[model samples]
Target chain A: MNYRIWEGKSGDSLNSENQKCTSRCGMTSSRPGMARRSFLRGTAAGIGGMAAMAAALSPLRELEAGAFNSVEEMLQKHYKEMTPDDMERALARIRRQVEQRYHVRPEIRDIKPVEGVEFAYALNLSRCIGCRKCVHACVAENNQSREPEIQYIRVLEMPRGTLNIEQGNHHYDRPTVPDDKHFYLPVQCHQCANPPCVKVCPVEATWKEPDGIVVVDYDWCIGCRYCEAACPYWARRFNFATPKIPKGALNPNMAYLSNRPRPRGVMEKCHFCLHRTRQGLMPACEEVCPTGARKFGNVLDPRSPVSEILRTKRVFVLKEDAGTLPRFFYYFDERYPRNTGGEAPTWTGPEEFPHG
Target chain B: MGMILAGLSAIMPNLDSSRQNEFDGAQPGLEELAHPHAEPVDPHIPGGALWAMVGFAALAFYFVSQPALPEMPLAATPVVQASEIAPGKRRDPIKEPPRIRVGAFTYGCNECHSLFLSAPERQGPLAQHTHIKLDHGLNARCFNCHDRFDREKLVLRDGSLIGYDQVPTLCSQCHGTTFRDWERGMHGKDLGSWDLSSPRHVRLECHECHDPHAPAYPPIVPLPAPNTMRMGTPVHLAHEHKPEAGNPLAPWWMHVAGGDGAAHGPGDAHEQTTHHTDGKTESAPSTHKEGGGQ
Candidate 1:
């Protein structure tokens, strides 16, 4: 039985049979020879596997070393796990990277959420002129890729007489906006309370902060694009190729979870300008809106603009049927479209057009 | 001197003939100019030489008489203050109140209006304030907003005068709903900070965004449309769906029939029913109906 076992293990039946009597049960002299033969065979298989692995990774050699992440970045912890010291180190590394690439030493910080502050956005549908200024302002603020343009906002020109978004045209090219026959509706990340994008993330690379901003950990994301697919608003943008931005156009103010220059194959979206908003500044889109259509503020305080809007205005969210419960809302003012020949009352004199 | 004189003399005959041809009105024939021998030679300190000397003298006199270029001043490098360069600090977008330019000087509305007496009745088409197009949808009278006696102040419904900064209060008399929204920072633009506790919070005045005389917003040229569609096609060209066809994403009722040259879908009957219902409701929010008198 011992002799048969030794022969089976060695796969050398004829030789094993010749030495079986000595090697198997009692003799120790034949043991060294059998061990040497098995060790040589194992080494050959191990070498073959290593060669295959090296060949498989050969394409990575073409990647530019400077553009790729350093050893420190590759091993950096997730945003939630990083301590203050780790964050400082990460920010320093980011600053160095940005300075080296964009020639601007960005004031990058890992801005923490303020206590008791929850940000929400409200847009006036009646006032939005379909100008697309908000969209461009967002791109400039977020340091989005220019050529392959990753804009957070998509303004749709919906024909009058319907609230249906499907009936909206995203690519409306008109001489002027707010066409007599059409109204504009701009769509962006709703920052949902029950964000499906966060739920579907396999690695938990994205999460909602205490302040209600859904942010992505660009370093931790594996670029699987599950979150992009799960998002109903199509807000998440996947960097298909290396993002290109002019050095002069890059916004020097950056944050780890918000508008930092993202590497290729990472997911990014509107963090509601968390870098600026956390510092109590208005979002870029809201600031650039010419018609005063965009409004953003803390929803926690009763006196906050968003809170007032919610309390007073008949606000509605896009894709409400999806049960997203978005922080962003859309509302309308009570007024006729200007210059529409609506039967405005006639004014005889100052008596009729009273001081009021 | 001799060589110079000889060169000037050689060029003189042609110049004289050309000048005479231009100014004297008796033009020389091309054949006479081409064949110099066809014309008699007259050389009395030729008219061309005199003119050339005059031109040279004028050129020399102009250069000598001109003032020397002032020493180029060093580029005025702006001295940036520390507070100006401080991080997170932004300059205010509106630095000063609106002023009326009268002749060479800019003056506040009260400066000139204070000198004149208040008109008893609504005056005819204004001669001075002609630029103020009163097209604010029936709220057209000047005294409707301006105080009759106090030119600097805005008049309210209660016949009380308020300062220029209080335009919102004056606007609120008629635009109650909009003013209510503006009070909460919902209607007009709010800058600086969303946090109420922050010292930087600023709500813009009504007159900042809208013209007082013509409250209705004017049409402005929109920014260029997005050109980042898939397959590298521009947005406008990529989706060239005809406007008459209505939006492709539109519901069957919203879509115009006979677009794309195809027969109507099975929802044709349902489309007609919904279309009639939709016509009555319209797309406007219910608030427009409730708050109608704006």
Candidate 2:
């Protein structure tokens, strides 16, 4: 394609147009009026030139949505860095977007953690039938994206004789659970005291609250996905596409640091249903469990259900050796927890769990 | 002197004015001086003032004659407590069997036991309640829970009778650990406010989940499973396969992709995951005895 016809030495002639362009650009041009005429002619093309430009840049925009929302999103201040007025504007912006897209006026509030209340969840593994009721309850209560099927809870089925999480199957399904030889262990975000996800976020989008719940500011998340990679439990989920939930299925009850409709290209995980929990109500997952396996309450209160579970039952945390200091605990009975009574029910310890 | 003068002046006016008005309007007589004989005024109260007095009297009479409010059933008792409640406010009753029925009918135990003498032993193989099947864990004996003397009440290890409302007491006789857990709001379902002080909170009794006759949870269906996040595609159940020996931590999608993991869900394979075809199969009593029943 190549002849150097438009090179510095190959100018054809100086024109009046070159003089005008040279004045505007402040470049010493021989044919200054030529450039100025072209600039006006380009303006004359109007949106047609824009169409041509868009077509030319279409390949790059396709790679990443470098369109309208990106520029403002990239300039957004970190959630923690934003002032109260900034937060109000951001929240209002989010509320408008949610209302426009979902046709629901979502109350996107920044719900504060209650003073003197630190929430903890306890699941009775012996009572848990691995029903997956808690899992779906979370999906409905939290505005989870239904298309990619983001669920907060994953009930793993372990072989009879193992506590090895690596050997557990998260996709366990059955008519009735407590599969004679198999037991279930459901995993979600642990809301750790020392969370790697919070530590790894380049932007301070996620952090641990005073109530011990780890939360993420949806607006501040830059979708770097470092948190997802850092978490050992696979707790964080990334939104690959703009999350498409039907307006009908949207849970209008939303909170800023927890389960509001997240923008595309952000990371989200469970926040222990902070919206409901902070309001003196049980979490949706705990309320829906049929076998009464899930228990949640304020840890500070001596009489709370979680306190009782922690005090009396033999409780263990997943990946205890990892030292995440999880607030979620799993307690099991001594094999025959239901029958610790009259007839001397025979059973052994954890070691006797039938190995696959 | 001033007082005497004032009294004499009042007397003089009556004497002088009465005589004057007598000649002005009255027929010329000293007897008519005080009465002014021309004007015949009626000695009655004015109509407007009388009507005002009547209205006031009627209003007072209506208020005085109004009926009193009826008495309430009980006067001002605190609603916060009962001798035996789960731990919170008394709410809608728990989901459980409504108390023991007699024979094949829905009659209460006291209806029949009130007449018959309490039996020391089982009545006979021909007993009416023989239709009943008890397959709870190990503590399966009838006398272990039910009172020998009072058929209507539950018996603790002690010879005392426990009312239906005190079922947790009857249950706590041997299951002390679970009772403690339940008291602290752990073991049982506390369908109430998390703020314990809030009203309408209730901890369901043990019988809500376990049938008294069959305490073991019956095999039932589960809620739907999570599919690919954001896509509404229902995950396909795995055709019969074995679970992979390792790689359990590899995320649910990895297990599903491997095809070996979906084998655990027996319901999904047969008769859509929603329906339970095998739930009715345990009607026969033989298959009930096991847990070795954990």
RMSD of 1: 32.5
List pairs with backbone clashes in candidate 1. none
Q: CAPRI band of model 1?
A: incorrect
Quote the lDDT for A219 in model 2: 70
Error of 1 at B260 (Å): 11
Superposed model 2: Cα runs more than 4 Å off: A1-77, A336-356, B1-108, B118-132, B141-143, B229-294
Candidate 1 residue lDDT tens string, A13-48? 545544544344222222223332223322332333
- Give the Å shift of residue A275 in candidate 1: 0.6
lDDT of each: 0.67, 0.61
Residues A1-356, model 2: lDDT tens digits = 11112334324332333344335632222221222222222232333333334444444533433324644555668776778887787778778777767789988787888999998989888888787767776777787876655777777666656776654555444665556666778888888888988888887889999999998887777899999888777778888656666557688888888788877778899988899888877777777777777888888988888887798888988777777898989988765444322453422333221210
Retained true contacts (fraction), each candidate: 0.31, 0.22
Model 1 chain B scores worst on lDDT over the 10 consecutive residues at B285-294
lDDT of 1 by residue, B1-294 (tens): 334435544565675566543432121222233444554322223344555555654554454444333232122222222222122312232233458787999997668778987555454578676777777777667777777776777678788887776777788898888888888788877767777678997767777777777767767666655544321223322233222232233346435443352323322221111012234421211110110100
lDDT of 2 by residue, B95-190 (tens): 332456557768656666778875444322436677766665555456767765566677776577777667778777777887877888778787
What is the docking quality class of candidate 2? Answer: incorrect
lDDT of 1 at A116: 88
